[model samples]
Target: MDSIFHEKQEGSLCAQHCLNNLLQGEYFTPVDLSSIAQQLDEEERIRMAEGGVGSEEYRTFLQQPSGNMDDSGFFSIQVISNALRVWGLELILFNKTKLSDGSGGFLH
Candidate 1:
């Protein structure tokens, strides 16, 4: 999908940006960081201090009962994959690691 990169606001809004990128051309309404934070659980809310959300916090939000993982304050590979799955979109993960021989290998 063609999407414009959104710069995060004062709070944790990485997830919002990711969602915008994923659904920019889709039929979903655009959402802001505050709105996303409002949906976060208590624990996830705490993680939204200053630096915004991290990978762990994003992951936790994805597993919430609401299943609105795209409304998290941050985004990670796992979070993005989960959000895409909710919309029937498939995501492929590629991991590149450097070997002892100074060569790169694709993991899995």
Candidate 2:
């Protein structure tokens, strides 16, 4: 590898920084990730609607905040996975892979 690229941590946007640093450039911003999160939220809502929008469960889901992201800038793994998919990259689950170094990070 060449010189390491590190995006200084700002606020609670670790996912955004991680993605940019991992890609070795400022390829993603908070807005970009948030947009992806919103899309995921909509997809989830649609899936829940498939179970009947009039159902209590669906109503409850609609009333709840998005699972993909929150106001504090936190993002779910699904968001990260989707962001990486844009670059043709994949994130392998830690438990599903053998970690030779025991380091915590996406294997792929």
Candidate 3:
């Protein structure tokens, strides 16, 4: 499928934009950012906060694999994976790492 591009807001709306792009079509209604943000729990919101990663709460959130739909500022791999799974799709992540040596090999 061709993706529709959307520039995200300053903060806390990347996932909403992603969802809008993913669901923009006749059969799917767009999701609202505020609605999604409202669904987040206190802990998730804290995790989403700027510089929250240094906090113990964010550390705890990272340790757990549950509650994928909590609007934690940015969407993690697990969140996207769970969202795709709900739509009967699988999420595949790809990365390329460049070699530090003089050789031009890339690791995938």
Candidate 4:
């Protein structure tokens, strides 16, 4: 299948492809990263499947902080810690605030 590389967001490329297939207006199921990687060469595969860009493991890891937890602190302590770690690595953390405004402008 044809694929394109875009900026990172919440899901892996496999995840996004699974999502995008659904966004074409159908139901989606999880994808196997290995299957997706098989379609690309090593560098493209790595670009597509990196922990931050194509982070299957990281996506599963994200649910704990945002989903299940006890005592607000029990939840938040780990969440803040992870955020700090991502921020500490400037490259891995994307600035999600930038948006394109309809009035002929971009917000940065």
RMSD of 3: 9.4
Each model's C-alpha lDDT? 0.50, 0.91, 0.52, 0.35
The CA-based lDDT of model 4 is what?
A: 0.35
Give RMSD to native, each candidate: 10.9, 4.7, 9.4, 16.0
Ranking, lDDT, top scorer first:
2, 3, 1, 4
Question: How many backbone clashes are present in model 2?
Answer: 0
Which 10 residues in a row give candidate 2 its minimum summed lDDT? Answer: 97-106
Query: TM-scores, in order shown?
Result: 0.36, 0.85, 0.39, 0.17
Which is the winner by lDDT between candidate 1 and candidate 2?
2
lDDT of 1: 0.50
Tens digit per residue, CA lDDT, model 3, 1-98 = 48665544546646656654675632222243333323444546565555566788767766765453443555555555545555687765544654
Per-residue lDDT over 20-104 for candidate 4, one digit per residue giving the tens place of the 0 to 100 score? 3433422222232232322333344345446584477655553333331232212222232332333352213234565345433
Candidate 2, superposed: residue stretches over 4 Å from native:
96-108
Clashing residue pairs, backbone N/CA/C < 3 A, model 3: none
Model 2: how far residue 93 lies from native, Å = 0.6
